[model samples]
Target: MAKKQKEKNNEVILALKAIVEEKGISEELLFDTLEDALVAAYRKNYASSGTENVRVDMNKETGEIKVFSLRQVVSEVNDKDQEISLEEAKAIDEKYELLDMVQKEVTPENFARVAAQSAKQIVTQRIREAERNIVYDEFHEKEFDIVIGHMQRKDKGNLYIDLGKTETILPPSEQIMGEEYEFNEKIVLYVVEVKQNPKGPMILVSRTHPGLVKRLFEKEVPEIYDGIVEINAISREAGSRTKIAVSSNDPEVEPMGACVGPRGIRVQNIVNELGNEKIDIIKWSEDPAELIENALSPAKVINVIIDEDTKSSKVIVDDNQLSLAIGKEGQNVRLAAKLTGWKIDIKNEEQYEKELQDALEKEAKEDPNVEKAIDSDLENLEKLEDEADIEGVIEDVDALKDAKLEEETLKEEEVLESQNIERDIELVPKDDDEYKFKETDETETEIVADEDYEYKVPEEEKED
Candidate 1:
């Protein structure tokens, strides 16, 4: 009978070795599963098993489980089932301190075959959890990129995509509007997020992701892949109009034209893949006004007036071009807003002209001088903003006061000097040779002899 028990002990080691080899897991990590399962089995047998916390350490050389039951050190050892006195705890672990949980070795004789089976089950579960974590990390790094997903099945009208080692359940909320997907159809998906769930890792994928547009461009446009062109921004309404802004590193290469391809084939293909969606290939500009104009394509832009503080761009197009600029249901301007991070308003020439007139009339009432002044101040403000040097505040009122005072003094002196010049001519000795003899005199003194000499005088300016 003793020999049979020894044989069973050897069998357990062999079974554990096979599990570690098959799962490609270290024996030490496998032992943790063994310990947890054994504790569960121990609890099922006795109510006092609350004191049981199985500790498992695998021998490095033999890869066998060495089990121990842990108990906390206590002062009075009142609940001896859950805890032991300090002296009792110290018998197993000499370095044991008060409040420390010390492990007491549990021999094979202490447990039955049920505990061994439980231990085996725990090890299997732990190995799977570790494997899932490894898979999660591998896929999480591929966020914002295109990944191929095979349709796994369906759940409540939503499609579940199987990404080989990992699966993504694409919710109906994320599906393209008015678009239908087939079963087992291979589709490209965007990895939106990854999170850890109790069962395993949950990877969220999006069918209508803006990143999908960017990734498609990277795939089709060689300039984008070669670093000659970069996708600056993208905005999409999912299976509808998608706007993408591209910037070129090479001066000669037109990034917009390059993305559009010869005969518009490149972007057209991408559009077809997105349920025949329209694509606008726009050139990216650091200037928000220019970028907004580009983002709203198929419409000629007459002018763009932007408020830097609010990041609003008031776009003016010809009356005939208004609908094209705004697009169906304001989508063109909406996409432009998203692409450039600006609030955009598309106005026809007539609407803009009327708005301009109304604004001028309002300003005339508020400040008449501003209405008289040319709108070149608007251009000047734009220039300042472009140079990133805004807010040119008035330095001081004293400077302006000094300028006004200097102008008034100069005007008074000019009037008085004119009168003095007239008097000087009469004061002369009535000959060109006597011009030097006109003496400096106080103002209002008439040097001209009455009924004797004459001089020409300049006309005075009209009073305001």
Candidate 2:
């Protein structure tokens, strides 16, 4: 009977090793769980003993179990089972102090039988808990990444994807529109999130995510996978169309060619996977003008006007390609705008020229009197040039007044002189010839006249 009991203990130890290996659970954790379960069983069966502080110890190698009763050391003991006198505690261990717990073996001989009865049930519960944690951790690492899953079933409006160990939810919002999901069909999906629930880990995945296209390219193209080529941006309308911009890190490698592969085989594979969705893979440019031009592909772009402050672009394409550049209901330009992260406005050459002409006419009509005012001003300027010397007209007013005053004074003096001449005249006879003479204190003067002339001198001179 002793040999048989020893073999039974060995079997329990072996079974613990198997659980740890198979369930990805820590061995130490299982030992702790087993000890706790045994302690609970001992308390429930032996409750009449009124032992409140009981602990269970288990040997890791042999799986041997033991129960211990813990009592706190105190100066005075009131409860015999719970409190031990300091003196008694020090007898057991000299290092023990007041309030310290002293442990004593109290394993019931029938405890082994009870533990055997409960071990299987407790361990199985523990295994399920460990598995839930394992799944949560695994899916958490895969969030925002790509994974292959099989269509499982539909629950209400949500679709379930079988991702091997667990199922992920694909809500209607994330499912690609117009695409059929058949049972057991393999599909590629992007992991949007991983959430933990009481049932297990709840993984939320999507087929319409732009990340799915990026991951598909990474999987198909060696250059993208190896980092020679890099995807800059992606915009998708699931089951309809997608636009992806790519660039090359290495100068020697071409990003577009690398993504397209030899003879379009690589891109074709992706197209087929996405239910024949049209994809335009364009090269990325650092210059906004060049990037906008490239983004509006499949249509010949005449020019691109970029407004850096607004982060917007105006793309001009050929007249024939206007509908293509704008796409059906502006879908083409919309996807381009999303991919380039810029607001795009598309126009054809004829429409752009018409807008330019309309703008000029509108400006002219805004202020109708401007041209008339300008022409009138020009005529006035010309009249001024012919009428007066600009420099002379601009002379100081005070200087002109002074000049006029001086001229008037000179004329007044002349008038005064004429009066003096008329008043001071006189007549006299001189020698045999009749001559008129005027005599004064300072000098004498003679006047000769022609036959028709009459001369006169001052009356005072005649008297002299």
- TM-scores for every candidate against the unseen true structure: 0.64, 0.71
Q: What lDDT score goes with residue 1 in model 1?
A: 70
Candidate 2 segments whose C-alpha is farther than 4 A from its true place: 1-8, 43-54, 70-84, 94-101, 115-125, 155-157, 361-464
Q: How many clashing residue pairs, candidate 2?
A: 5
Count backbone overlaps in model 1. 2
The sequence of per-residue lDDT tens digits that candidate 1 reaches over residues 118-146 is: 56666667778876776677677886678
Residue runs of model 1 more than 4 Å from their true location after superposition: 1-28, 35-55, 59-64, 68-106, 110-114, 124-132, 222-228, 250-254, 257-269, 365-464
lDDT score of residue 226 within candidate 2: 97
Which 10-residue window of candidate 1 scores lowest in summed lDDT? 428-437
Please report, in order, the local distance difference test score of every candidate based on alpha carbons.
Answer: 0.72, 0.79
**lDDT for position 330 in model 2:** 88
